[model samples]
Target chain A: MAKNLLDVRNLSIHYKIQGGWVYAVDDVSFTLEKGETMGLVGESGCGKTTTGYGITQLLASNAYLKEGSKVIFDGKDFVQMSTVPSKEYKGYRKIVEYHPEMREYRWKRISMIFQGAMNAFNPVFKVGDQIIEAIKAHEDVTDEEARKRVEELYKLVGIPVDRIDNYPHEYSGGMKQRAMIAMALALNPDLIIADEPTTALDVVTQDRILGEMAKLQKREKVAMILITHDVSVVAEMAHKIAVMYAGHLVETGTTRQVFKETAHPYMEALLAAFPNIKKEKKERLKAIPGSPPDLANPPKGCRFAPRCPYAKDICLEEEPPVVEVAPGHYSKCHFAEELYGELGGGESNE
Target chain B: MSEENNDVVIRVRNLKKYFELHAGMFKFWGEPIYVKAVDGIDFDIHKGEILGLVGESGCGKTTTGRLLTRLEDPTEGNILFEGEDIAKLKGKELKSYRRNVQMIFQDPYESLNPRFTVQKTVMEPLIIHGIGESYDERVEMVIKALEDAELRPAEEYLDRFPHELSGGQRQRVAIARALVLRPKFIVADEPVSMLDVSIRAGVMNLMLDLRDKYNIPFLFITHDIAVSRYMSDKMAVMYLGKIVEMADSDEIVFNPMHPYTKALISAVPVPDPDHKHGRVQIKGEIPSPINLPPGCRFWPRCPYAKKGICDVKEPPLVEVEPGHYVACHFAEQLAAGELETGEEAKEVIEESEKIES
Candidate 1:
């Protein structure tokens, strides 16, 4: 077996509600190689962010990872040990003792770059001070060493070192994002989970920032799990992609497999929803009617069946198991195999 | 109805908007510097075409939008809405002009008064326009407007406040108010920039759907090219408060004539892994609009700038290919021939500056 960086099996992260558990991530599983970029995509409320939180063991108070869920990352089982018992679960017993605390893996091993970086940094403090604090908090570096690291990180992220003394407000939307990336890289973590990093930026800035991030990933050999709604942004960086709809994995495959040959109806709707430059100016866009379902009480059958045009009787009666349609291509729909890549009516080989 | 059907509705020429920097508290004797927000940009909005005003932050896209809707008067130049100088119109006539052009603001939360209910919000525009004579008539109009905006089963949404509704619903209400007046042209300023991705398409589709239903022309101002590409019939690229490029939306995206247009196109993220990902990355930062560089406003940052001419002489908007107009000294070079990349242009600028000094 090849050595993988992050691997999970039967991963189920749940949220407490009044009547029943939310099942934010139900039996969700994927792996990230040492230096690969995997895109975790979904609609607004899907468990993409929660999955990131679960991997980092930073799940919120209302959320908890179920027992027997195995998450092996960097030779450490971040998931708690089983009470059902095993010889290898001796070291994991300590983590099992404390249910809430995250074994101090927040900043050192992996970090997350949240959406709206403007609010991530403090208003009062200068960007320079923030970077320095980030460095010192993770490692045993002195103030001077951290300051030097801050300058290096600033220059690396394309923001001028001179602007380090400036407050966060003085920076543009893109520049603020660079400062956030600089702070995140200050710890030199192996993996960075970025959530909608370029959501607020203009196209020009978005391209530049994404380019910088791609370059940094290449040079550092760091794994990036980018979560965004923009398919274009995901296509730019991520090698493999996953499309989530209403907390279910609709499609997951290589970029070529997904973009060229989208299997699920939700993916088809999402692609059609995007404005192609080839489209006529005054032409109407056919929107996907009916919003995502309520996670607390999702539908009996397919969560996306209400909005899905190709939905059938079976789709409304039972949840489709995620099956491998092709070589490493997975989708959770009863009719996915027959209807694979039929949205644009193009073959995967094409 | 298309843009040509109704004829040209709005035209702006040599529009210059400069804000005088008032002297601070201490001395108050220094010369007041002017912040030229909109510096000599010209474009036309044909009868009902969705003319997109595109640019990054501080490029005066929003300011130009405000000027079009007459939310703010220009410091200099004329905005001919239906062949009438909007600046000259004031008092009673200006109030009437306001009804002809309604403005949809960016933040739906801030634009709407929190205290007002959906019915009251939609009715304010009706009352101001002084249409639908009776109270019940006005209520009828409001319901119709709500239905048009996709707030279906209008009765349920009538009494709900802005806070009670979702972000998508609030934006729909904003659209409803704008539509209630039955305006010919609307300046929708960053309408969906704040909404969630899933909901943004819904709001955008509503705008386009309403455009067809009302035959209403919109001056859609947005920084996102994807939205602009889908929404705008004709497009204008603004750089440093000036109209740098103008052409049909498809033409601009597929075959960008101007260097700025090319850069902007390359900047748009293409969701195709087969595509070569290393795009033309413009480094540094957007120069301060307050102290804009001489010659071409973009010449300082333009990749194609050459010699002392760029620093000393400004370029005019020249017709490069048919309807495509680009404002650049090297527009011809790019139009007839492929010149160089942004990096190569930067190198040329460096050498030229060194020789001049």
Candidate 2:
């Protein structure tokens, strides 16, 4: 098997509130190979964004990782480096004691495309100068070389090079998003974490942007962790899929395997929630009933049991184990095996 | 157009709303530029029917809804509500007209007053319109409206503030407020876009139930085509302040005639991974509304736009098929697959196809 680019095991992060800790990301684990894309999809406050921030070690000041959490990147445990500084970690510890080697690793090996591009850019500075600053901050390049790279990035993201001198306010919504992507790819990082990149864009603009991002990811061999609530976008962009609900990974599998033979009830409900334009019959969407549980004091057993349609007494009484339904597919549910068996047997019914 | 039938609740004819843009230091003397927000759009909402106005952000769907609710005065046109022109109503007459037409704003958090309780929020509309005879009567009406909006045991939420409720619950309160007046027509602007996916269907179902129960016509404005298709009986595709296509929701989504509508429908990402969308990627961004193209507003970005006709003469919105309106010079040719995709659009698709492999 090809060496994994990133391997996260039992990663748990919690926010320190007034009374208790908010279990934002609880014991979530996943692996990503180089040039592969994994989509982290869930509704609001389901810890999808927190998971992305945990991987990058850019969590907020109030948030902290739990014990035994491991984020092994390129054969090195990044979580361990932060807690126990060694001789090789002295350079990182001197610069930032909290996040070891993050200054060197961030934007050099992994970059983030934020949710709101308008707020991400500096309104006072020109778009080109901001991207050039990003390039110059990481690499020891002169202003001329950074400017040339910015021009090339503009072309790559389908933005006009002449508009690089304009401020962020001057560009349209689509143009600003392209500039955000350009800045994320400024250093040619190995991985990109894009959180709702196309959520604010129009449908046509979003389609074009997703297409461009997919092409660039393939050409540059960059792994991505696309965090979104839209399942269709993940279906189109991601090779592997991870579904989250109430700070737990409900399901994780290949995109085709997960979507085709859905094991977890949350994943099934989520897929049914979206209105498909291609569906032959116009049927009412089966909306998942009730709201997500509070993370500060979540449910005892399955977090999704309160809203799940197939919840039984056992689901509420005991935590479900992660069962491997297929060779590489894992589902965190009590009836994952039974659901997978039924779905596999009746594949043609759908 | 038949007055005897009396089915059409709101008939908007040649509606135009142009916002003037002033530039430069001596802009008072200079020719003032206008952003043609709702430039001569015409549609009718029949009784109990939901006409969905779908488009991008600046495509004037919201402006049309605002005009229908009499929030914004149109520059020129006739707003015939039940065959009476309401374009210039004022004072008591405008207030009476507004009592029959209500608007549900997009953001429930911003629309509701922060200090007001749910009871006061929903009751203010009734008090303004003099809907009930007494305080007790108005409270009863508020409870009924809240119940109609799917907020079970409405009394439980009477004293709750906006912040106390969740996003979906806030939207439900907004819907109940709109319903308290029992208006003949309602304009819902992106009602469920801010809501979570899990509870969005419940809200949509509530609206559908309300429409059926009251037989009230609706003007549903949204950017998502799939949601519009599910909610609307008739759908209109707007681009650059004009209705590019108007047809039955299923017909328009399945067999779109206008190039812009085709591109819009095709652009919607379906949930199925195996289904391959017939990509009709339009080039470039929507042109600035202030300086719109001379002829067809979508010609600059349309994949099947012709040079001479689409650039020189604006095509009138004509019925190419039964009950289907299309505003394109080559609508028939494009529908027949006689016209080829533009060169630039083809190149863009080819360059962006590396991911499919």
Candidate 3:
């Protein structure tokens, strides 16, 4: 079997608050093969963004990764390299202290298409010059080479080459997002983390952009971790799926397995909540009763216990084990086996 | 259709609003240029019916909502509320008309005053309209409104400010404030777009419940077609400044006639992984409303547009079916699947294929 392009295990991230810590991400584990897309699906404040940022080590100052977390990319454990002492060096010396190598890895090997493309670019710089600067920063290329590359990228992303010389303000919202995608692919990175890349664009623009991106990802064979709250976008783009709740990964599986054989109640509710144009008309969406629990003081046991329709007393007393009901399909619930059996029967109880 | 339906609460005919764009510094120019935000739209909202206005940004859905609520004056056409033309109403008359109509803004965080407590926010409408004789009466009204909005134990939130409440709660407060006046018509502009998916259902259900209880007609404006279809009984698809299609929500979603409407529906991402829609991807971005095409506004990006007819003359909205209206010259042929897909659309489809290999 081919090696996994990215593997994250027991990844936990927390942000320091005034009084204590906000457990943003907890015990999340997933893997992605080259050219595969894994969607991190969740609501706001669910820590999906934190997990994406943690992969690139681009988290804010207040955020910290918990000990024992592992981010193994291409067989190299970044967590271990950043924290553990080097065996080849003298005593009490940590290898790659402060991650000076991370700067080289970032944008060169892994790039990010951030949310809200409006604020991602410098207002004063020409969009073409910005992409050229990114190319020049990563590779030993002359001005002409970088300019030619930027023009090629613009054509690849379906933006007219003439618009490349215009300022970011001169471009439309969709064009700005296409420019952001161009920059993320400027250096031919092995992996790209797109955080809600098409959230602000219209549905038509979003569909076009996602189509372009899927084609681009497949052609380049670059792995992707798509972080978004829109389930439909993920269902269309992602090969694998990970459903996140308050601060935990509630479910992970192939997109088909996750959608067709959903085991977790949170994932079920999320799918039911979204209004589908293809569904039968006038079906009232089942709304989860309460908001997500406060991260500073999350609920005991299963974090989604309060909102889960099938939650029982055991769900409140102890943390549910991550049960693998099917091959490569995992659900963090005490009743995963039972739910999987019922879901397999093609009848889901309300 | 007869205009004098007793059930209709609000009737708009040939409504147009043109925002003047000043060229240079001349006060009196040769000819004043207009943005033509909401140019000649017509629709009727019956009591308890939700007429969804769906379009992309700059498509003038919001402007139509504002015109209906009387927030902006129309340059042409009439907005008749309960048989009275409310377009020219001013001062005390307009203030009284406002009592029967209210608007719920898009952002709850920015819409509500930070300093005003829930009690004050809900009661201000009553105070302005002079609905209640005493402060105690207005307080009671406020509490009732809050309860109606599903903010259970309304007293708990009466003293709290907007900052203290959750986003959904703040929107509920905004709804409560709108309901305090018992308005005949409501203009909800993207009420649930800002909310999370789980919480969004609750707000949308709440609005549905309110409509059932009060029989208040609503002009629901949003860019999301699925949400619009779910919330509205009748749906209108807007392009630039005109209603390209109008029909029952299900008919419009399932059997759209207009090319633009078909493109919009096909563009929406379905949550089901196996669902593969026939891709009717349109080429290019939406044209600027300021410099709209002379003929059909959507002709430039339309997949089935003809060169001479579509570009030479504007198509008037005609009822292709009994209750379905479409503003396209080849609406009948398109609905029958006889019209060929334009070359540009085929090229766009080839260019946007997912994973060519």
Candidate 4:
């Protein structure tokens, strides 16, 4: 097999809170193939966004990658290479990760389209100027060549070519999203990290953008990491999915496996919480009770045990390993096999 | 649900709202060009039915809500509330109409003043209308309103500030404020859009419960089609400033007739992995409201816009099925949906596009 495009092994990220350190991404390990799409889904503050940041090394200065953590992207141990200090003026090793050199990998290797496209471009400059700047940053091309590329990208993402001179505010939300996509694809990157690209958009606009991305991904064969709360979006776009819970990788599997054969209760709870528009009349939705655990000091064993109905003594005492219950399917619950049987052909699901 | 019944609680016909933006200090007196936010959209919300107004951002969904609620008067249009033109209401009559037609804002965080206590927030509406005689009586009414919103053990929340409560709780306070006035109708503009995933469901359920208990009709404005499926009895899909399709929840979701409506439905992420709802990748963004293309507003984005008639004329919303309405010219040629793959996806989209033409 060819080398993986991205490999995250035993990667744990921590934030120094009032009470010690919060384990935001606890020993999460996953890999992406050359063209496959991996979806990371969870509720707010479940560490999916943090995992995306960890892959791009975009964590805050207070946050740190714990010892033995490794992020190997495109044959480079970026963590070690990124920690080179500039000088010892302050005596303490003021770690500098994601340096200016690392920026070469940021847009050229992996690009991101965050939730909102509001600040993605400067309001003062024309949208074409911004796209031109992005292209000129990585390419040794003249302004004319970059402008041609911008026009081509605008056409590629379905933005009218003539609208390039317009400022960012001139475009609608959907147009802005298309512009963001166009900017991200300016350099034919191997990986694209879209963090809630559709959350800010409505259904129809989101649909068009997702369809554009799907077509582009197939055309370019780029590996994508989609971070979102909407499970159904993942069902359509992703090949594999990893679910997070209070900084834990509780479940990981194919899209078919996770939604159909959900082994983790938190996964099941998430599915239950969402009211399907396709569902029939008079059916009441089951929203998950209580809030997520305090991230500053999470639970000892299973972080979700506090809200889980099936929690037992062992679950509260020891952390469950990510056990492969079936081929290409993984779950981090002690009662994984049992929950798999329980999730069989749910009522109102069909 | 009647096809010919015209029980108009709020009738907005040929409505228009235009913002005058300036370039610089010299341009302050310059001829301000209109944004044309809501340009001549006509709709009527029936008695006791939850009418959903849905569209994408900058498509005038919020503006339509504000116009109906009288929060902002239209530049031109007949806002007939209970057969009287509300746009022409005088001071006392306007206050009475305001009490009759209240509004619940999208962000509860902003809706409820952070400095005020929960009791004060719920009581402000009552105080405005001068319902109660004494402070004690008003406090009693405030606690009762909290109870009506299902903020149980009402005293616990009464003392709390907006920041002290969760997003769901703060929204409950907003609902209580709207409900305290005992309005017959309300304009809920993306009420649960800013809430958490788990908390959003609770707010929706609470709104539905309120609709049932109080018999309060709603003009629910949301970008989410699925939300219309949940809280609403009837839905009208908006594009630019026109209703492309309007019908019952089942008819709209399963048997959508407008091309825009079909695209909207297909884009919705169904939770089931086995369901094969294919997305229609429509070209171009929602056309600018200021300068909309002639004929159908959705024609520019319609996948079947290549058809001759779609580009020439706008189809009026006509009831094709027993209560299901569509606004597409080629409604008959479109086929019904089948399960999974094949022409099923195409049929689903074509049927809706038919209404748009």
Candidate 5:
């Protein structure tokens, strides 16, 4: 309804391999509102991480963007700058620096809390000094001012200020994660991309971290793109949910819509695959047959057709268009209505 | 199974493992600091039942698994396998015991050898145990193992290396290797934690199927309470280096009496958004195992701890409820709702303030 803070349209990212390009992320698009949380969830090699990395321009050397892709952030066409050439010198070949302005957006406007970020810190430096350096790198602040800000950020993330002086090894896994979250918030960024933020921690520590992040998100009003393979985590944290399989976004909707009125068969299978801790024991868990398709040489049509239980001949020959089952809910499936009808109703779900 | 007279497959009595640390330079200046990793633990695995050992990192769950498989010799106590003590087993007896008990590690990538093919990896266990008569017989055994692990069309995967397979495929190979010998008991330490959620259910179902088919008991160790609840029949909650509570899985999940168990259960994020978990936050960091706290090991961070009594003496594992064991001095009071939540620790603060005032 309101103007979206970040709009990614027709985004495709590929890696140049020996024979052909590895289509890591293909035709994936989603919008994130200001102060909203969107969860991008899938299994391994589902292009969930690549979508985040491509938006952040953190791809490796062998990777390159496909033609006709757009990433609009804060009313700016950031993806088009990749082809912008420098001024020609004496009618000769011109050098292209390739989106040097995008570097300025990093950490100041958009930042990331990486997976296994606790081990990413330098062991030699004190945690506070590292954060101080990060703060100084983005803004023209004095050493005294940066130090005070570092202390404040540490306290904001629920870490005791005194422990900020300790080295990374001195802190526990949970403390280091909290420290990473503090580092991501050092520059007051508008958006934070967290990839499996609490995967490595225990349940108790993960509970504390998720609770803290939720509190901080509400207080600071910073939009977040939480990427994880755990559906339960997304159910608790995000306002919207996007389900990806292979390199395709099979479904997208609000959290309630996706969880309650799921249309895509892949989404249904993925949901049933996870064992619910709160529910009673069933006779047997319904695990989806077969593995994810190979991204390097994925099949034509729908990527999930081979594993879809309700897939038909049309599903194998042509890819399904994005069909809006509800007002704001979309599923990339041909038989979405029939599937929903079979489930009885699209409005209520237990 | 009856409570008193059930046939136990593995009986662990007062198990202890203390790793002595050398602190000073040249190893001459300081007293040895013992990292009490698994200190005085006791439990029994019933025949054909899964005993889930749930704990956080550094809580000695993995160490307990390693000790059970004879990978690490216990410093004290007896590990009776089928009513026979295995601490003093040697040579042929130890080899035979190892054949009956196998271990499946967490990381599938690191567990299997890179150079070994799927066939070689599964066959190596059989070759070592001298199970089959000839090489031809071993090949048949390998194919059967792969099929039994649910890697159908086994011929297609025989030549593939670990790198060529997916995370779930590699884990199945690891399971195939573990099950090639048809072990009676297994110590699976977070087998599915390293896998993707979609494929995780398949592996869990395979494990349950194998357990039922082979009638094998498992010491399932994991930090995830949800996965443990799905897999294990009996659950044991561990903290620091001791079992804080042990009971039936459903009872432990529904009506947890121990404060630590309550905190752990409340910490687990349920998938449904409407499921509201009680907020029983256990504050502070777990104490370092190198120097454990006196009295109760959990006293430093326990919310329901009393001042004089809980800090003065450690409580033994008492059977407060039938078939439900708890190791806390105030287990009865806490279960009975007699003790306050200690939001401000009003009594403790008042008592300490009285001394100061």
Candidate 6:
């Protein structure tokens, strides 16, 4: 079996709002193996971003992790030990400050590629110099060594080495995003969290960037958590898939199993809602009837019960447990087995 | 509902929109640089048909829409709406033109006035156009427009502010505002891009219903090809302020002639992993509009560009097949399957085993 890189269990996050607490992430749990790419997909207000932030310890001041939430990274409980500043490693002291306990793990162990590539770079500095600074900040390396690493990174991301000296304004949108990916890979981290990295690029440009990123991840054997609202994007590269609703993980499975043998009604609805390029045109897209539930005051039972077509009396009165339909596929639905029988293969469960 | 009955509602001929770029340090002495946002593009929208103007950012798709709606003044060309050139129309001519041709913006939240209630927001257009005889008549018209937009119990939503409504609801209100005038044409610029995926379909379906019921022609502008293919009867591919290809949505999708169009169609991510593996590689980024290339704007990035010929001569939009127009130096080569060697081309050809011929 592959070694596990990250394990998150019962992870819940809430934001202190004006009236009441906004439950951003509720009882979310998943594990990622080395060299695996997991896609966390959801709509606008879903807690996919919050789950990523919770793992990285980068939640805002207004946000707080609920009690009993645990994040284990490489066997170390990050939630428990995220406050102790590192005193052992004396490298990169001048560049990166060891303030928060999680600071040491941030760029060195795990990194994030933010949503917008336009705002990722500093306006005044050259792209090459900025990357070198990032490298020097994370590791005990000379300016020359960092510069060499930056040059290699640029090449890895398919950027010309000469254009590294160009300012942010000088580079095109796609080139800037490639540079952002290069920066994220500076430390050769164990895991990477890309939050809608290609949302801003053109379709052609988005394909190129994603293909390149997928290649890099495979070559380096690095685990990735790609967060996006588009299911098609995740379907391209993700090995494992996790569907998030208002604040819960509605489904989890391997890419093949989830796409072929989907067990949740929410997943089915999402698949139907997606506009497929390969499929013939339909009269109208199958839209989920109602909007996502409000996180401030969630409904009585399942969060998706209001919009689910298969929603029943049991779905309305009690929360559904995460049931394993197949050996590896799990879905949070009251009738996961029935759904598997109905939509997955159309065979009787008996 | 046949080709014989279809009438050309709007004809855009050689539309151009040039924006002046600032010259740094030599502001007074140096010659001004013009960014040709929409450099002489031509197309037509038939009655009650959805013409999808598809392109990436800065491709002049939005500018073309704005020019047609009279929101932005076109530097050159004739916008023939109902046999009259409305490009240079002013005063009362412009006012009446605005009433006939309405616009639906991309951002619903920003498009609506937060201070105004739903009733006032929809009524503003009718009031400006002087449509109703009295206040009560105008109120009745507003209710009917809201109902037409699929916002049921229109009276209940009249007093609600824009903030109280959802993103999809707000877009419905925007649609209602546009429909209140009973416009002959509607320019919907990325109307559903801001809404969530689940909510997006509702708005899209609503637009289709309105198109069918009102028989209103829509110049739908979007970057998303899937949505465009779903909503449009005809689609035009734009690149660097030029129409690279234009045809029936099926023809443009199934048998793309232009290399740029093929690459664009291939670039869209399908929800199936089994569909394709390798990406269609376009060499470089979209060139800046200010310093467009000499021969063809897309020559630098096109994979099938013939070196000497493509760089020296601009390809005119020609009809190689009936009703399908393509602008490419090697359109013949592309159609012949001569350039279909790579994985990208293979993927595009076999986009699905299920697509009906």
Q: Which structure among the candidates has the greatest DockQ? A: 3
True contacts kept of 5: 0.68
Model 6 residue pairs with clashes: none
Off by over 4 Å in 4: A18-20, A84-95, A98-101, A139-152, A160-166, A280-282, A344-348, B1-36, B39-47, B75-85, B303-314, B330-357
Q: Calculate candidate 1's fnat.
A: 0.60
**Could you give candidate 4's per-residue lDDT for residues A1-350 as a string of tens digits?**
23898888888777766647777888898888898999999988889999997777887876677666777888886666575432522211223754876788888989998878867789999999998998898989999999999999999888999999999988888899999999999998999999998788777778777877877887789899999988878877898999998998998989888888887888888877776888866477666677788788888988888888899999999988788878989999988887775863233466
- List candidate 5 stretches off by more than 4 Å: A82-98, A341-350, B1-6, B345-357
TM-score of each candidate structure, all chains considered together:
0.90, 0.96, 0.96, 0.88, 0.94, 0.93
Off by over 4 Å in 3: A83-98, A343-350, B1-4, B26-29, B350-357
Q: Could you tell me how far off, in angstroms, the CA of residue B324 lies in candidate 5 after the best superposition?
A: 0.9
What does candidate 6's lDDT look like per residue over B1-357, in tens digits?
113323888988888999887768555777778999999888888898999999999999999999999889999999989878999999998998998999999999999999999999999998888889999999999999999988989999999999999999999999999999999999999999999888998899899999999899999999999999989999999999999999999888889999899889988897775666446656778888999998978877776666788888998888888888988877887898776444543454453222212
What lDDT would candidate 5 get against the real structure?
0.85
Q: Each candidate: what lDDT?
A: 0.79, 0.87, 0.88, 0.80, 0.85, 0.86
Q: Give the lDDT of residue A4 in candidate 2.
A: 94
Q: What is the lDDT of residue B62 in candidate 1?
A: 92
For residues B173-268, write the lDDT of model 5, one tens digit per residue.
999999999898999999999988778999999999999998999999999898899999999999988999999998899889888998899888
lDDT for residue B303 in candidate 1, whole number 0-100: 69
Question: What lDDT tens digits, residue by residue, belong to model 3 across residues B1-357?
Answer: 343678878888999999998878544857777899998988888989999999989989999999888899999999999989999899999999999999999999999999999999999999888788888898899999999999989999999999899999999999999999999999999999999999999999999999999899999999999899999999999988999999999999999999889889998998888876555578788877788897888888888889999998999988899879899999999999999987877886765453433
Q: List, residue by residue over B1-357, the lDDT tens digit for candidate 4.
A: 343455668777778888755657636775665677877666677777798888778878898888877778788889888778998676898898999988999988888898999998899988889999999999999888899988999999988999888888888899999888889889999998887677788888888888888778899999888777887888888777667778887788888877778778877987777777665646556766666677777766665564467778878777778667777776645535322223444664564354233
Instruction: Indicate the worst ten consecutive residues by lDDT in candidate 1 chain B.
Output: B348-357
- How accurate locally is residue A326 in candidate 5, as Cα lDDT from 0 to 100? 86
Rank list by lDDT: 3, 2, 6, 5, 4, 1
Model 6 docking grade: acceptable
Give the Cα error of residue B306 in candidate 4, in Å.
8.3
lDDT of 1 by residue, A73-113 (tens): 78777775322232432221112333433535666678788
Query: What i-RMS does every model get?
Result: 4.6, 2.2, 2.1, 3.3, 4.5, 4.5
